[model samples]
Target: MPRIPAVPDAEAGVVGRLVYRLARRRFGSVPEPFAVARHHRKLFWAALVSELGWERAATVLPATVREIAVYRTATVVGCSWCVDFGTMLQRLSGLDVDRLAHIDEYATSPLFSPAERLAIAYADAMTAQPMTVTDDQVAVLEREFGRAGLVELTQMIAVENMRARGNHALGITDQGFDAACAVPQGRSLDGSRTP
Candidate 1:
């Protein structure tokens, strides 16, 4: 259980209930973070709106590119909630979820393309404290993605860092997004690491 209990869908009043139901339908469950955020109703609405806006904006990047970067960032930060949610998103999008097993070795793994490896390396650098982002990393990212794409990638990684860290600090954990959500491909039934 989370440090904060999820606000039950049935008792969240009309607006909360509707929001909860809509998110549940879209995501296969109302994410635990969303439910906990309900304690601050106004902020919850803002967060929901902001998330939707980011989703629309990120469409400029291809699905595989965005998901791999996001997933790598989440894993680097050790956010189980983000990992679980990201795995489900990848599965729902029909990306190769099993390939994630090779992510930690992306530098040498053929499973990740050149683009993905670069993005993953950048995510790794940025996630580390006293960040190690180098000139070569920026140059490569800028060349591959252009300035705007680099900006998007940086913002997405930075945002995930904030989210993952916050969720970890708050004792907010996964809600079975990679198990109970839409037949997640690579998660064990007990939510353990699965090969």
Candidate 2:
């Protein structure tokens, strides 16, 4: 359970109910963060809008590159919820989720492409304490994925940092999203066990 209880659907206002409905339709459930954030309506809407905007705008990098970088950031931050959700997203996108088992060895692992390795390394640097991101790293990323792509990549990593940190602080662990992907029909969006 999270430090703060999620606002139950019955207690959610009209607008919150609509947003929750949309979330359930999109991701098979209202994310715990969304439910918790609904306690503060304004911040909830801001987060919802920001997430949607970023999802639409972040199309500069290849899906694989963008997703791997974000996943790497989540892992580095040790956010179980982000890791679980990221795994499900990667699987749904048809990326090689199996390769994630070798993430810690990505630098030398054959499972990751050279480009993926670069992005993963960048995520590590960006997420590290004191942020080890270097001038050379930025230059390399820029060279590989133009200026616009680099900016998009940076924004994605930064956003994941915010998400992972917030979730961790709130004690939000895995919501079984990865498991839900395996047997989607068996689970309900409201987190109820269905027969």
Instruction: State which candidate has the highest lDDT.
Output: 2
**How well does candidate 2 score on lDDT at residue 163?**
98
The candidate 2 region of ten consecutive residues with least summed lDDT is 182-191
TM-score of each: 0.88, 0.90
Which regions of candidate 2 fall more than 4 Å away from where they truly are?
180-195
Candidate 1 regions exceeding 4 Å error are 180-195
lDDT of 2 by residue, 6-97 (tens): 99999998888998998899889989999999889899989999999999999999999999999888877777788888898899899988
- lDDT string, candidate 1, 1-195, tens digits: 778887897768899999888887898788988898888889888888988888789765667877888888777666778888989888988999888877867899989899988898888788877688999999999999888888888988888887777786777877787854222345432223568
Give the C-alpha miss distance for residue 57 in model 2, angstroms. 0.2
Residue 112: error of model 2 in Å? 0.6
